[model samples]
Target: MTSAPQLLTDPFLQLPTATSVQVVWFTEFAGVNHIVTYGENLKQTARASTTKLSRTREDQQSRVASQNQDGQVYQKPVQRDIWRHEAEVTGLTPGVRVNYRVTSVQEDGKSVDSDVFSLAATPKSDTPLKILLTSDHQLKPMTAANLQKVVETVGRVDGVWFAGDLVNVSDRASEWFDDNGGGALFPGLQGRAKHEMTHNGVKTIYTGGQIIQHAPMFTCIGNHEVMGRFARTGSLNDEFDDTIPRVVAQRIYPDKSLIDNSFNTNTYEEIFSLPKSKEGEKRYYAVSFGDTRLVVLYATNMWRTPKLDGKFKGRYREAEKDLNNPENWGYGQVIYEPIAKGSKQYNWLESELNSPEFQQAKYKVVMFHHPPHTLGDNIVPAYTEPVQIIERDSDNIKAVRYEYPKDADYIIRDVVPILEAANVQLVFYGHSHLWNRFVSPSGMHFLETSNVGNTYGAAWGDRKREVPIGYQEDYVKLGDPNGLEPIVPTIAPLLGEDGKPMPYIASNDITVFSIFDTGTGTVSSYRFDTRKPDSEVLKFDEFKLKLSSLPLPPGNKFPG
Candidate 1:
């Protein structure tokens, strides 16, 4: 007989708060449902449940499961399931004691609740700026040790940050049990699990939703979020618009109508919506907490336009000039369209950085997906770079040189200069699937973390002084044994995109940053790992970004 869904956790991912705090809980029986009760410690606390609330992004689900001839198929259902959930309790006053609980909910309206948990809020005046970080942890997604470390760290820090590629693209229960949700997940993720399986020794991962929602999350879109590099080559297509993510989509089975709801940039704006917008812009704006101001950019989606103007003029000019050269054309791509800085986003980014309001901020923090540096990998953009810039993009792209490991460039063209000029404090990102930090000769700090879940095979420990040695090549030919490189098929299907496969390629996870308001105007960084057993953590670096009033570097090096 199958046991009903049930909560399978205790003190599962809880953290203290200065103001508003997000709470998370886990379950293994099947789906997860959270009903938090909080108020005057151990006294009267208001109650709220996950089922009653709603999300803007309307996620999508495939009508039917894909057929696999390989032996990987499970004898039972494997696609849909959501074993975790996170909820933000907004309008929370600072520095108060609050108690809470998470519940596991079922399809027939059955539910299992969590054991009680509590936290003492830090005084609003003295916000605890904390950061939990990790990089390149693919094969061991949510390893038991890693999960335990995460749980231990959250209780102390005020925020979290994810580097990139958190998990490997595997639909097997083993992988799902490890990573929260490997990249873009689809529907049916919630309905696949049953409570009785645990007794039979089912190793279900009760992560995902709870890890992110429990804290004010800042997401940096990574190559994984864009799928993989195979997407750039129209030849292969597998786009997963299911932002809830595959590992996550199967579990957090909410109402079907919410699929694709504000998913793209729209959904990002809502979940991560800050205290204010860029004057009248959408979600892309600068936020100020105490003395810290954060500027977020979407490298894959915008600001990469190849129009000829300001910063982009040079890149576009080079592409245009190389477009016709036969030998050189091999290295250039005229189809993806070089997104120049003179284009739409470039112009917007300029105004955002140059505005007096932006310049006035004390501590400027910038975030994006993709690493600016990596291990012993050589590429044209790798060597000879300045730290004054906070640019981000997919460098060392996949299937090119062994693979195109996206480095930091798109931001270099536009954001770096602007940030340097604004005396930005530091830069945070995840893409190379590694944990690395570089202090530019100019005293600016740059960090690349993303080992939260999966790193595939990308890991650089002590090889800090390494660079890409050769140029990466793409788009060779069909059946050409020398086709330069191979392509990876998209493992997860997107929600809004309903085509042969997901247009985006690669299988990775996006990074997130939690901006904490530490008194004295000093901000530190902490990265969070959301796997199981929750005891893993990357080296958490603490620093006071000394923003220089230095003029923009000569020749548009650092724009702001």
Candidate 2:
């Protein structure tokens, strides 16, 4: 017998305007009626528009239903039907919170109702807002613990600025709703997770903070959010890693849509209704939230494996067997979208940065996926498109390799200059799973506070990235490749083995999170050791946003 149809996720707030906010929810069945009930007595109702998800699927590795058994339920990737319902709760009083709930009635007359939650329209300019600055959850180990501590420490946040990488696989349905392990995206953010974490031989179950259900969340397209070419027979992971440059895809499949042949963000775009830009739609856009003007850029590229033994297609070279076929090449971490000077995204950004809205805002912030400056390994090899170099023996191809020119690093060479010139206060990003911050010479702050879960060890002193040693481009094995020094935490920085303060927190046991307080003009970073379930959350770093255009020397210490 089939189970009863139920809601896949709790209603979450999105795209908050002055007088309205979008309430979005999901379900396994296409319901006949889906509505959001709000107001004092739950008398007000808004009918919802339901649409089926296009690309969500489940593979053998998925943790759902019978798939969670010892043996694989799905031998190959298969579609998992899911429907999304969204309703705009209009005529709301700005900053006035009201109780709201969602209900969906199936074809058989059975209905499911979500728990009552509080929501409000956008706040006023002078309103005090504590926005969560986080990214790279990707259903990692400590994500539940990290978010749980967030609620315990600061209560509900006014908004969420998620830089990217919400899940490991963009089209995986279980990863977003219920992964069975209780670390799914919706569960973690909606306080419905049952994720268990064990440290020091003690076990604890964590329900992530109740945040996004109340406050709207804005997200960027991280590399993990973009799935490559579609594959009907093979593993979903193979299709995810099979992305090619648009130019190459066009040359190969002249009649196919770029999204179909190259790569697509259909699932990510379908999940969130974010503010749109004239040039890039939801892929990259700018939104005004109270005292802040936030610009989110599509500044991430395909992340290829770093292996170089010719046994796998990696960041530097193609696999030996695939060297002969141009269509099968990984293309060396090619960028998905161009943000270089004169490009569409760059032009839009340049205009947005100079616009009256951005200029007048109390805080101007830019967010993206890839790190412009970080101590983690993912920052190396530059952020520009790879230059393909073919090695041929006579007429036969021997090997296919790629190189990145430091001068062509788009984020560092193009985007940062424009942001610095416009006096952007903060540049937030993630990709490298670590907590690090840097201040540019023009006093612009670069913060990557995404140490929410596991970390790939930081590259400093003795630790180094696995960069190509004898490549034409000089990849800096240590320090920030963009030539900026990371700022040490102003209070209680984590100590290294040498007993000195470490600037970055790259730990598996201790997770970190950051809050951007618009009222105080400060961003405070906090950390919690998951190893000690009952331990206090420590505020490790806090820095005031620079208001003036005065140039600060590189590596200038932040004042407490």
TM-score for every candidate vs. truth?
0.52, 0.97
Candidate 1 lDDT score at position 382: 22
Per-model C-alpha lDDT, please?
0.37, 0.90
Model 2 Cα lDDT, one tens digit per residue, 20-92: 9999999989979999999989999999999999999998778987678533788788899999999999999
Task: Name the 10 consecutive residues with the lowest summed lDDT in model 2.
Answer: 551-560
User: lDDT of candidate 2 vs native?
Assistant: 0.90
Q: After superposition, how far is residue 559 of candidate 1 from its true place, in Å?
A: 8.7
Candidate 2 Cα errors over 4 Å, as ranges: 1-4, 69-71, 548-560
- Model 1, 295-391: lDDT tens digits are 6555432112223332221211223343323222122111111223565555666666665545665556776554443321211232112122112
Candidate 2 is scored at a TM of: 0.97
Give RMSD to native, each candidate: 14.7, 4.0
- Deviation in angstroms for 388 in model 1? 31
